[model samples]
Target chain A: MPKASSGLLSRSLAVYFKDLRLELRTKSGLNAIMMFGVTTLAVVSFALGQSGLSPKVLSALFWIIMFFSAMSGLAQTFIREEETGTSLILNLTAEPNSIYIGKLLFNLTLLITMTTIITPMFFVFTDASTDNILPFLVVLGLGVFGLVAATTLVAAIISKASVKGALFAVVSFPILMVLLMVLVGATEKIFDNESLSAVSSELQFLIAYVVVMTTISLLLFKFVWRE
Target chain B: MWYKLVLFVLMSIMIYFSFALPAPQQQIGESSRIFYYHIPQAWICVIAFAMSMFYSIMYLRKKEIKYDDKAAIAAKLGFIFCVLATVTGAMFAKVTWGMYWNWDPRQTSIFILLLIYGAYFALRGAIEVEEKKAALSAVYSIFAFVTVPFLIFIVPRMVPSLHPNDSIISEDLKFNIEGAISLVFFSALALFTVVYIWLFNIGVRVQLLMRKQLEEEDF
Candidate 1:
């Protein structure tokens, strides 16, 4: 990979292209994420009795699927790189900040796309009606951003652990608190017929969290990746 | 080590103030004395987590094992402060709420924090390799600290509570000599921080010494 200027967006785009092409050929990451999302929703619905899946409940369900689904997807982000011995290759060629942003963008894409596909399936199966789907989507969208940034950093750390999959949750559970709280709070408003304006504060919080977390991740990626 | 004297001086000052600091204008009398320990411990807990997260990130960026050691020390200190906070809060609850553990939001949140950090140390001990241990521990510390705000801020809002709701300063509850009270609190925070630093330095040196001893044996 040729080195690009330090503009995060451009670097992220480049790395995204690289991962996208690899993903397109393999389709492994996409297939795995979607499968995890659908399966998780199915299990949750079956266990909880689909009758309880109201629109408000669906909103909460939507973020839960994204969370756990993205978790499984991200668990392997750095692991796959390391397993293939390409982590060092990629790290050597790309700056740490670029790698962090690139991974973050890619993870966000994975989470959002999976949520989009799985959410309608949830509505269809559970017969839930979301009054204002836009707010729900926006809340989920902001949440996915926080998830990607937070999980990406964690995924980097757990990739070096002896137990990658199990440790990912241990590492991410704490960091996911704010996003989960905001997601649940904003999602519950769907039941009460509140305006999107109510969720604006949470969305702002998510955005601030994303900025702070990603910056820290960017600075720390180089050290963690050194291994 | 020099800060030990400062800690003693601050401790004496706090003790002196504890006697004179009037009770809040409400029902509580001598029970309010718990605020000095309870509030400062909460502050220290937050500070310790912040230090752990900062050092964790530094460890990842610099690939310095020292940062990992520092993070671990910070986390241990944070855990200790959290325990003290929980105990003092429980003591306060026993006096004010007529129960030691009411499952209040603050109590529950502190328990959650304890679990998270407890799991952190457990995870560190389970991992064997030097590099892998540092990396995994750093990741956990970062994530766990990131979650602290949620435990501190959001969990409390999840349910109603008798614990005084979040307020930096309450007008209704006034300390006539507020400046002196703040100085007392600030001194306690600084004292705890210095003690933490001293302990952390000792921990790092001990670990280094052990590593050197292991290397000699290997040779």
Candidate 2:
């Protein structure tokens, strides 16, 4: 028999794969998030009409699209568990930390898929363009991870609650506010084609935000997961 | 009961010194008086939040109802003072900066703090099961307080803040603080802390009463 430590990685991976399989079967989480992203992008670009938009506006708009899109569906990760009556069985099988890691991975995958589809569409539809792809992607990557770490735990909390709708945004906005602020600042620099030196501080802040959020969530998840 | 008398005395002293004794500084003029209320309210907000998180950790470790009750009351008071800080700070900003809402990084950070605890209450209100409500909110309080340091300290440094009141409760360290003003400030802080304790005890009593009534009804 494999010891728990020996199987920890594979255990989490198995949970992740299980989520992936379920996601492939229904794709509801993917569809809702993507549709919201694309539709919001279309509306925003249509309203602006490709004229004299500033770097700050473009950067802010990009996150608003991504942020709202995320809010639309991320809670469904744990909500699905409750709704489907599988949470109890899943609860009995995997360690709480492993379950949390799996749910976080699943949420992150859904976010990535939605962003991948919406990101280029954002630049295409809107007049926003970034000259520095690498730094922008770096910020985007960290920002997404921060959002995932922050929101995934929040999603878990709300999943158990009766009122899920507004609470997610209320709880998540505070944690994400710093992340979104730095991302917008970094993205504005990317828009202006500024050197990495320009966005270095914001990037560092994002890295810190990510580390702090994930650490806190990991510590608190054990309490949140169990009865 | 004796602590209540002490709270009353502290409140009276805090009022007199804050309203009458402290010398108003130049540049900002008379409006600077807002600093007394603003600073204490913000401190209460921070301290109360810390207390909530402490109780949250306690709840998680002990799984006790009383710990959850302590956590809940602390957070609720924290949220109340968070709003007070925001409003009082907004008024202060209006006088100093010519607008009520400057989106100062400090203001924005406080705004974020408000939302975090607001979500805490919302989470509490959502669950019908008593134990689940307590446990989930305790967990969330811990999660939310984790961001307070980032919001209050790191965010301001990251952004070039125009807020004159950037210091997080550095009122004592100010060179501008005369002995009189220092007396007032410390007294106000003591008063606010007592007020918090008073409110916290009241909240716990009410919670206990509610639980008792529920038990009686079940019987």
Highest DockQ against the true fold, candidate:
2
Candidate 2 docking DockQ: 0.75
lDDT of 1 at B133: 82
Best by lDDT: 2
Across B87-197, the per-residue lDDT of candidate 1 in tens digits comes to 988887777667888666567667777877876876787678877788767866775665566556655664333245334124223544356666665666676667667
Residue B212, candidate 1: C-alpha displacement in angstroms = 3.7
Model 2, span A1-227: residue lDDT tens: 12356567777777888988998999998998999898898889889968868988999999999899999989988888988988888887888888888888889999988888888888878767766888888888988898898999889888888778777787788778878887887888789999788888888788888888888888888777786
What TM-score goes with each of the models?
0.78, 0.94
In the order shown, the chain A TM-scores of the predictions are 0.90, 0.95
What level of docking quality does candidate 2 show?
Answer: medium
Which residues of candidate 2, in runs, are more than 4 Å off?
A1-6, B161-175
Off by over 4 Å in 1: A1-11, A50-59, B1-25, B53-67, B90-205
- Candidate 1 lDDT, tens digit per residue, A94-184? 7777777777777777777887798788777766666777887777677777888887877877776666777777657756755675677
Q: Judge the docking of candidate 1 as incorrect, acceptable, medium or high.
A: acceptable
